[model samples]
Target: MEFANEPIFQWMSQFAYQPGMVYAGLIAMMALSAVGFPLPEEVTLISVGILAFMGAHPAHFPPPYEGAPVVNVHTAAIIAFTAVVASDTLIYVIGRVFGRKLLYHPRVHKFFPEHMMKRVEEWTHKYGAYACGIFRFTPGLRFPGHLACGMLRYPVWKFLVIDGIAALISVPTQIYLLAHYGEPILKYLRQFKLVLFGIIGLLVIYFVAKKIHQRWAARAASR
Candidate 1:
């Protein structure tokens, strides 16, 4: 835990001030996580959060298509959405390439519980690669999801297309919210006021609900 928060990690914080560097980092970081490194994506995202506050965009351009001197958060998110999609897609392919070897490694195998891996395989087999979107938000399960798609032989073109659509939904919205309350977020955190708890709480609820659904389905399958 301490290692993850050390000067090394803080140094990664420098990506916040550099737009090209940050996007590159985001791609590389997500790819690394998607490739099974287990560096916390949330922590990488928080750097972007601080950068967003600093008026730095982690994305390439973000969108609106309006002609003017410039666009705002929405535009920036739109522009960067494509990059986000590409990053995850490449990671998915990398996962497919190394899925079996990674699965055999004791550490990587731990990321996927034996039974859960079976469930992911079954689900992806039935539902196809679109499951990536559903599983992408899942922190621990993400790599497994990619592997499952690969194992199930989900079509690559379809997977990439669906991943892009999902990125469109996920990346921009996250960036926008980070920008919206950038200063207040920093101020509150400094003061320990923490109103962002509401947003984080909602995401937790979403995760818990998904977990519950997965568990219930698993139990039913056993029955």
Candidate 2:
């Protein structure tokens, strides 16, 4: 596919021959993303998926890589699932240890602003421990939402069970599907890139507008 030539894909291709390094990099990226790294966790997951695809179809790759050991899709998926849960559990531990006091730390407060924290509190109250599932689904809210789950003292077991289920549904599925069906998927993506991007743009605008309206309502309520 044309995307194989893209810079990010090209970079990932280098790891096609080193399964160990690929797994290590995946764990590192997931850990960093869990702890407020600027990059999205999906990017790393997608890269891993692509790399797994390359490994299975080594003939598509050039030179030495064609005969080298590479990432296995199933193993990659397992590592991804474990890494994500571990990273998320770490965030929960931090919140539980620090309690609400953690929220007010200068470094932390900036990430979980007053408005955002208020929403997190509302979700916790509304959904109880089940809100952990919501947090797992929403990328922008994951870090702060998971933190609030711990701060509010939801049972650690419940958080793990719920988050683990969500992670299972999301993490491994991406890798398996991409590795098995990369060519068709890439072809479709290239064909409908504009349509897909436009839909994404609209979703972003809708969420931004919703947030602004919520903030305005909050301000009015205070008055």
Residue-wise C-alpha lDDT for candidate 1, range 123-159, written one tens digit per residue: 6767676788876666666667876666555678888
* Candidate 2 lDDT, 1-223, residue by residue in tens: 6666655456657787789998999999989878666566887887788788877765565436336788899899999999999999999988989888886665566555577778888998999999988888777678888888888888999999999999999889989888898888766766776897698688768756765665566556557
lDDT of each: 0.59, 0.80
Model 2 local distance difference test score:
0.80
Task: Indicate the residue-level lDDT of 45 in model 1.
Answer: 58
- For model 2 the local lDDT of residue 17 reads 77
lDDT of 2 at 15: 83
The lowest-lDDT stretch of 10 consecutive residues in candidate 2 is 58-67
Q: Best by lDDT, which number?
A: 2
Q: Report the alpha-carbon TM-score of model 1 versus the true structure.
A: 0.59
Give candidate 1 regions above 4 Å deviation: 1-17, 56-83, 94-111, 193-223
Can you list the residue pairs that collide in candidate 1?
61-76, 62-75, 62-76, 62-77, 62-79, 63-75, 63-76
Query: What value of lDDT does candidate 1 attain over all alpha carbons?
Result: 0.59
